[model samples]
Target: MLYFIWQKRGDKPLNKSQKAEDQSISYQDWQQFFQEIESKLLRWRRDLHQYPEVGWTEYRTTYWLGQELVQLGYKLSVGKEALVSKARMGVPEPEVLKQAENRALAEGVPLEWIKRMEGGHTGLVACWETGRPGPHFAFRFDIDALPIDEGKEDGHFPYQEGFRSRYRGQMHACAHDGHAAIGLGLASWIACFNKVLNGSYTLLFQPAEEGSRGAKAMVEKGWLDDVDYFVAGHIGLQPLNIGDVVATTSGFLATSKLNVFFHGKAAHAGVEPEQGKNALLAAATAALHLQAIPRHSQGATRLNVGKLVAGKGRNIIPDQAFMEIETRGETTELNRYMVREAKRIIQAAAHMYDVQLEIVEVGEGLGGESDKEWVDIVQKACRNAIYVQHVLPHLQAGGSEDATYMMRRVQERGGKATYMVFGTPLPAGHHHPCFDFDERVLMVAVETLGRCILQLT
Candidate 1:
């Protein structure tokens, strides 16, 4: 385990007469702290990038993070203890999960930890209680990779630096590796400054964020029920400078992901053309009409059939077809409208072809906005960080995030919540095969968030 308790004997205390620049931790102090921890940040990010995990199959990542936090004197809640077992969404099949578990075990994750995460329960919550009176603060960091193969070309930085993903078709194309690194860095800072801090801190390492699937389970487990302040941040959403940070965000669209299947009678295509129902045609028709869902007059609505698979051979009529579809809208009502329309179109297509249909909802999320009070608090913290060159008051996300679940849960119970953006220039757009960001943003995020926690407490 990495030693994170950075206790120095000659540190000075804050003075009322001192200038803002001469606070307890000044520019020089931040610089020194970053210098001391830069190597560990880079190491963590690179290792995670090379061995990326996806969704509820992040056994190795969960074990590694849990061990680190345990070494730092944190109390941990893993697997079903950290998430509601029945509430998890978009989980893989039992066989896929078992394969992932075996891989983690082969890679040296302990059997005890593996058993705890059996059945796709793979999230963690770490807490530190100071036994003093103050506000409870929480930070969320997503720990899942996308289902994209990493670029192996010489031009890619990870390939050039020998840290490219080792798993086929699994890569950290969304900078979740960087987010996890920043979470560990902030955890170290909290441990180092425990003497000056009071109250409690909770860190949530969420899984399956790519499809907006993880946060609801964590929230349903009551992690945010007692939170006084909650914050979550993402990296490289905008093509901004490494040190630019957005304190708040808006325009997070509500979304739903669905898996639709069609069943039909199979017959020899050439010998009995009239005896079979064409499942492929039904799926194709549904895919076409799903894209044509009328846009809502009240707000922006979107729909897509991302994947479709059907047929066994050219000589036989396909008996089964499957489709992966998604719908999004500016608000919950608008999204619901799109989903209802898509379902109607799908049912009509199945009926027209005389095929049986089954629709399964895989993921969902709600749109949310940050509380202005917490946004101002985070902005002030960003302004104080020496590594931060620009502080943006607000940003338009143009996407969906499950973090909205936690944010809404906290706000509903009279607490404050905000989603932040640690801006960094990306070499490619998110989810692309070559997606990567400037690693310097890692420390900048840690410093800004660490300061925010201190300010809140």
Candidate 2:
């Protein structure tokens, strides 16, 4: 059902029929949708790629997407309107968050949207309902980019063409840009065909997904309150051909992101060194001990100190230092154990070095158990679609994803939910500078999801 057209590079602006590795696909279930939204999908992808934003700080991205979805005839809720304040976890300090909002305002985000999204609370929920009433179905799409410089390599397509990221140190290295495009494409389908569609539909364009930050807040805000069935997905996991789709994904590692700070009195290295309490030493010691945390005998476990910075100058006993770390485990209980041990190690290091220490959780996500019956539903839906050539029964996820937070919530309240992967060929692995995917996957995702929603409702 899927085939690749190997071609030598002789490009005059590649199009639907071309292949360099030609990462293009042909769709079956929705032909008019192909013609109607195909060009729009590519346009939306590039426009978002050009103006990338990181989690929580996705002010402009949220505003733009909100406007578009509302224009497509769906009712929209954003910022504090859709998010609960006290429920927001792992938030940056007020001033730091304000700067990001200010930057978005100066860059042209609508003031109406900006006002609601103040303090970096950026995400939205769009609802399309048939007044006659039925079960409410939900689809989630994450909308945040990574903090990496867009590759300026001349051969890179984004740079070669006109739509590369305009932001200096932010780029859509992950496929959120594509995910947003797919969500919007799916919205168009839902809006245009609502009369024929059953049940009510809700689409979540979640913010700050990079650190497992956004979904919990939405869950607490009751975003999935009435959801009867829920589905969420990512673009690519491991490598696969253009038309492969993982109908059920499990084993998203439960994880926590933490920021550690150590404070002490600074002093000159040669003068009164004895008066100084070295924070740098305390932080460095804690980092090493954190990594040496014993592996769980029960299930898989992981710990990493992704960043450590201290010391202002060579002549000073550093009085301040910082560390950013994350812990992961195959299950939620195991992750909690690692976090507990980590805190103990940090407290001991602070006492030994006579420095003040603070450990703050900036983000967190719990592991999930994919309901087998829900998997069967998604599998049957994909198998029935012409767009999917392979319907993977069970492909466990290798990384942590916050979508499970919402999934668990829906399931907790007598709802059925599952996370799937819209598998597609990639030019490079996720989070790499050259990451890109076959655009045809967007079309297939719409059709497959549409089929599933239709079947469920």
Candidate 3:
């Protein structure tokens, strides 16, 4: 059941070369390719949207992608092989991970896959080696959802489309579901054209991207070490038409995330007020001082104590307190300054209250800029994209992305890397309860990256 789809007027020629080999997949061929799988891509996204999983808890999502990739003849690296275990940051508690794993198993993920992904080791790297002489290209697609409740209003697109999240307090509010689907679509295209391709392709279905957590582990495992080119992209970052694409992005902030705990001695406030050590007061004071850290002179710096919890009851002095904190800077050194200053304030507050303090760094990311060479390549590739109307040179991200770690790793080794942005109309901003993007962007991404691979290989 294939359709002879024709290119619309005003579209750029997909291949301008006179070579016969370049005509192997003509513009009509790509239209047919996309037509055949468009429904499958939508179904995949809806299925993923229905059952969202968060960082370090994406067993089902991993399995869902892995099973299909394996069937596509990719040599797979799952769990420990895909990411360095000790390098994983901001992992959930052991019990929480176990519960997620149990839920995955209950939901029909095979025992074999579960065993490989036990201990919260989720996500996989799928590789296709052509055994021909060429460059190695690595592309990353994050697959973790956020901890947000989906909107159930009649006007909400997901609700109207019957794809609202089924998991309570968990939703794919950041377009990661669409990312995973696009990755799979690209994998299918690559597998179909394996005979015509050269060199190798590695697709990283990365997880735990919500807190800037995931890429470091993959980078530490040396996944991007041999990559001649690395590319990663996000959908709908800006308010742009669905056909717009940004070839390169700038202004990624470096950041560090932490969890701080205070321990003190509890006592009856009426009978033993002097004997009590109030952990609550220690944490509250630290939160205040953490915000008061001197800003760096070199660049913009930010610090926030997002959450704080303490105390047992009204009559008893609190023996424990916990805080979630983060610091960000325009540069890595600037972020380091904020983190260092916040630590000093935390330690001082703990000492002043005579309470034991523990500070655990949960996540970190480095600022990065896209390579111009690769950016040019992406811009050229986007010209062949079926849905792409305009390819912007660059956009200011003004945020943090863990993919910077992989980009740096590749660039430091003398390879080229770039982060791309596929623009799409969004119902709501990212991480919001009603976040939803135009699904047409899925095929746009698949075509854009698929063309890049074709041009590179």
Candidate 4:
């Protein structure tokens, strides 16, 4: 069945003449269109950066995108919810793959993937089709902000320049603003010359990536059923020169976040100390023991207690306590081991202190290993594009992403997946108050993705 689907998607080998012609046309058209859309792309990026929204609440952002799509002459369909669009690929059927290939050959640029999804109110998919036939390719972009307040004082770019977020306490601290804008820029440019693409393609604008929820929901809802190849990128604070692309070769750490609570009797410190069980003491003891959880000798492991709250009054023995904790490892088996060991230590501490204990799982993310075939394609594409430097292959990474859910899903269904890191010079590291990224790197990312799509399709 899988082989049949591959053949039907036009995964057959191309002759030398056909390949050369396709590459020539794709290169010429991309250069021309990128030049035409540069200004609009920059403006769109700035607009999104100025008014950031958090997670699933990208109301204004989604609305603005919808308006843009309508202006571009694409057929827009409302998603299951508001602030979302399920935009269809352009005319030409027999599946989107063939149409995209035909379009790429004819127009010099390829239009393989563009489909809008109904990912809550903030999700959208834009699909492009060439008249020829082939497999479906997908590129995912996450568009959501963090819960931090935007820079408010004078001298900050957003505040001083008068482009700060209208929504207080919501900002694009994680650089997702750039991601959304780049995706939109790609969509707009691709739509203009849909005649050269060889196969079907879908561009997914996902929401709630901060909470690690959106990608899984999209998959469960069948947003990737027809996708054969999937790709996504993220902006980071590494010191690599602008436009340098980094691809991870091995799996990253799998993480599980937990909240542990302990309940006990409250009493006066001096008068009723003997009658009260100290939940605060138990929680503290558990936290200390948690730190002692040995880092696995076989693979990397980590345990962190980020937050702890115990008592309100100095004179009273606190009755309740809670702590936010995380356990991580290089693989699922190791992560599970660490979690189980931590749980044992917490339970033991609670018993010793005579306090009731509860553990709640807050968020979880699995690690991902790069697909060698897809990585090679990305490397070649980056090498071919200007302003991009291909660094050495990554051996392992500690970064965690919800996109791993999408990658795993695709693998389960017999598809190829690759996640790359697009380097941008930043003054501060990720998730920091001073985090900032150079915008020029985005142009390289856009060019790299465009080239990769052309080659793969």
The digit string of per-residue lDDT tens for model 4 on 227-252 reads: 78888778773566665676554566
Winning candidate number (lDDT): 3
By lDDT, rank the candidates, best first.
3, 1, 2, 4
Q: lDDT of each model, Cα atoms only? A: 0.87, 0.82, 0.87, 0.68
Candidate with more favorable, higher lDDT: 3 or 4: 3
Using TM-score as the measure, name the better of candidate 3 and candidate 4: 3
What does candidate 1's lDDT look like per residue over 41-94, in tens digits? Answer: 989999999889999999999999888888888999999999998888889999
Query: For residues 1-457, what per-residue lDDT tens digits would candidate 3 score against the true structure?
Result: 1111112212233332322134457776676677788877878888999999999999999999988898989999999999999999999999999999999989999999999999989999999999999999999999999989999986677888688998899999999999999999999998887887889889999989988989999999989999999999999888777677788887899999999999999999999989999999999999998878888889889898999999999999999999999999999889999999999999999999999999999999999899988667876665545666678889888889999999999999988888989888776899899898877678778877888888787
In model 2, the worst 10-residue window by lDDT is: 17-26
| lDDT, residue 381, candidate 2 | 63
Error of 2 at 370 (Å): 2.1
Question: In order, what is each prediction's RMSD in angstroms?
Answer: 5.2, 4.8, 3.7, 12.6
Off by over 4 Å in 2: 1-29
- Show the colliding residue pairs in model 3: none
With a 3 Å backbone cut-off (N, CA, C), the pairs that clash in candidate 1 are: none
What clash count goes with each model? 0, 2, 0, 44
